[model samples]
Target: MRAPARLREDGPLRATLVAIGLAVFGIAATQFTTLPAFLLEPALQGTPTDASIEARTMLLILNFLGFVLAGGIYLSATDRGWSYVDLRMPTRRGWLYVAAGVVGSVVFFVAVSALVQLLSLPTAESQVMDFVGDDQTMVLVMILIVFFFNAPAEEFLFRNVIQKRLYSAFSRMQAVVAASAVFALVHFPVYTAYADSLGATAISLSVVFGGSIIFGYLYAKTDNLVVPTVAHAAFNAFQFGLLYVALEYDIEEAQPAPSHAIDVVLALC
Candidate 1:
């Protein structure tokens, strides 16, 4: 009875618990690996040059863990017997969805940037000059990896797996909120990385968590990760492009932006 009950009764809950637990593990792992930078960057490197590299590597590993946990949740919670779906291939309509998401994200991003100023939140402004210098090959490869591969992988994990699985046991709003909270928690490292003040980090995290819930809702309603993934990828790409433009063009100031991802979320029900 115990064995059968464990397999069938509390499967989703168990999976969710595991998912959250693994999140802690992943964060601790990254923190442990990068502790040297936090303590020794100023003394050894004279600057935080290698600090950013460690952060990026940590992000990559976290994403990988997210994929695993999401996959586990999807399999455990859903009745569907399908194995992992290939995110690399999209249908014709999927492409259209991607385009629509890009446009919607841009509008939302610009609007939120303007709106956050009204709240008197301190948003920093800085830019990186191109992704890998003037090398065209590097840019192309980076775009391919980010858009075609990494973005889709993340979307499938969050939307199709974690969000959907949670919705089975939790209310739609609760599921969205949970997924978004987890998403924000996964990004805690970045909060510490770029923020100079605790106040700034708190504000930024609120914005991120809030916006993530919206994205989760959209993903739930659409029942397709393609739209959300495309939006996510496009937003990042635009940000990269913006960084390049700002760094190369010598802008006196670029406003710090807050994410408003919830704008795209319209409940299908």
Candidate 2:
């Protein structure tokens, strides 16, 4: 779609490499700073705490930077500036696609979470729920990480850059498949580290990869990154808000579960 947005050899390659390198760095950096804050300071593995809030906030900021850098690289690589495009706003059909993506993602989360619980997968290294039921500021900060930082950055890398690059090199259909695989690779460490059951992990990840394919197609069809970016953002924002409500009301566990759907989506990509 849209001729795969011709690439400038040096322009795209340089940018992509930088983005990937930075993301790798972010992972290392995140662990070094985050582990101690989460584990040593308060050590609240099951419940939300002030220390956990600080630790997660710090790590989230780092994670946000990683996504921003990568997204910047990806956008530059395609010569698609950061400016938003209003060309053909979401048609009814486009809205349908977005809706499907959201529904599928939710199903994936529920199924995966259930599997993780049933299988007794290893718990997340840090206490994710420990951020819930805390100060409103802490909750807001967590929201920023999941919605603002994590979602956009990830979709840009997976859907915008990798998906488009592969699409440039191959047919549209093949590009979708290839991008889906690459997206899945990004989640390897997280998924393996988080999932409780092998079978559930596999099935859930398949759902994730599948979602990537869909998102990739949406980007290709629209030749616009905003569509996928918004889709990604909306999906994440919804989950975060829902989780916040659940935790705030004590209806669901506050900390993020390893089998968390959004996490799976990231892994799927």
* Best model number under lDDT: 2
User: On a 0 to 100 scale, what is the lDDT of residue 85 in model 2?
Assistant: 28
Off by over 4 Å in 1: 1-16, 25-97, 123-142, 192-194, 255-269
Candidate 1 lDDT, 25-128, residue by residue in tens: 43344344444444543321232222344433333334444454546554655554345343444567666666666776677666766666677776422212
Identify the candidate with maximal TM-score.
2
Q: What lDDT does model 2 reach?
A: 0.56
* Stretches of candidate 2 exceeding 4 Å from the true structure: 1-55, 71-96, 107-127, 130-140, 252-269
Q: Candidate 1: deviation at residue 72, Å?
A: 6.4
